[model samples]
Target: MAPELPFDDQEASTNLPLATQIFRFVVTGVGSGILDFGLTAILQYALGMPAGFAKAIGFVCGTTTAYIFNRRWTFRAEPSMARFVAVAVLYCVTFVVNVGVYTYLSHLWPETVLYSLLGYVIAQGLATIINFIVQRTVIFNIK
Candidate 1:
């Protein structure tokens, strides 16, 4: 049985349908991605920070945003320390995969704006797929 929620139905997060979950995940990811890119641009260009450092900071920001929204709306899971740890570990893996793809692509192509965006898209796409599968099947499965 589901645990009793000491709040209204609106405040409780029930497991959503698959279609609804995908829709929510896309929406949440896009929003987080925009913030990530914006922060990366600001840190790398405006502040003259290194790309690696700036991207690291941006990735953390974006991941944090995604986690908060995904927890509440996408998976509708009640928060737990174990869940948080699982997500953190997942993010660590994704971070390397995402950045590694982008870095390899950047090296292959000239450092043009188009290639940069292309690299970001490919890396982000891979990470998103991994994130959704792992989160739905593993971390958030209890919900």
Candidate 2:
């Protein structure tokens, strides 16, 4: 038997379909990634900050954008304090996961642009998969 969704049909129907949700995720992620890379470049080059510090700033900005879009558009969940906390925790985990990948790649590549890019690619891909699973199954309680 199929499990009942927490939301009523009318509310659920208002949400985007799965394909639409994925499209929104990709669009939002690309926008956020651009913001991240821009900030990283400015901080690292213009401000003369270290790569790690610049990456930190970029990650925070990008993750903030992602949280807003994923919660409202990708999952279409109602906002609440508890939901925010749950999502925040998830972001924290993703932060560690992403930075760890970046740091590891940096060690291997030693100041190459590909190091940073590869780290972002792998970390973001993993984070996106985890976020979708956790948000739909647990935090939002979607069917």
Candidate 3:
């Protein structure tokens, strides 16, 4: 038999309106993005780490934070190993895409702080969109 969840099946369903979900997602994303961007900036500029490495570290940190909040607050879902594994797979795909986009844009653009920020935005924006869609329709779709 499957293990019981902390919440009942009814409670596990994500019934939030789409607008509310998107708003909460944006708020969560902004908080996560700050941590990501700050860590990347510090590692790359202060410690002289490579851009890709620094961004990878930052992305991991940010995504971990996002998963926690998105699961609990945004989706209002109980914990499940299946959901966890699914999200892990999704994040792995996004990780490659996010880092690849950032690396390519950083190389293509002139080396400037503004351009670096733009690259981060573009990469993060794409990743966020993908994450929201998959998480809503697949991983967190308790219905």
Off by over 4 Å in 1: 1-11
- Which segments of candidate 3 are over 4 A away from where they belong? 1-12
Model 1 score (lDDT)? 0.80
Q: Taking the tens digit of each residue's C-alpha lDDT, what string does model 2 give over 45-113?
A: 688887777878888999898778666666666677887888789888877777677667666775756
- The Cα local distance difference test for each model comes to 0.80, 0.71, 0.86
Report the C-alpha displacement of residue 110, candidate 2, in angstroms. Answer: 3.0
Residue-wise C-alpha lDDT for candidate 3, range 1-143, written one tens digit per residue: 22233233445448878886788788889999999989988888889888899999999999999999888777777898899899999999999999999989989998666887999999999999999999999999743
**Is 2 or 3 the stronger prediction by lDDT?**
3
Shift of residue 49 alpha carbon in model 2, Å: 2.1
Model 2 ranges off by over 4 Å: 1-15
lDDT of 1 by residue, 53-140 (tens): 7777888899899998888777788898888889989999999998788778767887555776787789889999999999998999
Candidate 2 matches the true fold with a TM-score of: 0.79
Please report how far candidate 3 places residue 64 from its true position, in Å: 0.2
Q: Deviation in angstroms for 83 in model 3? A: 0.4
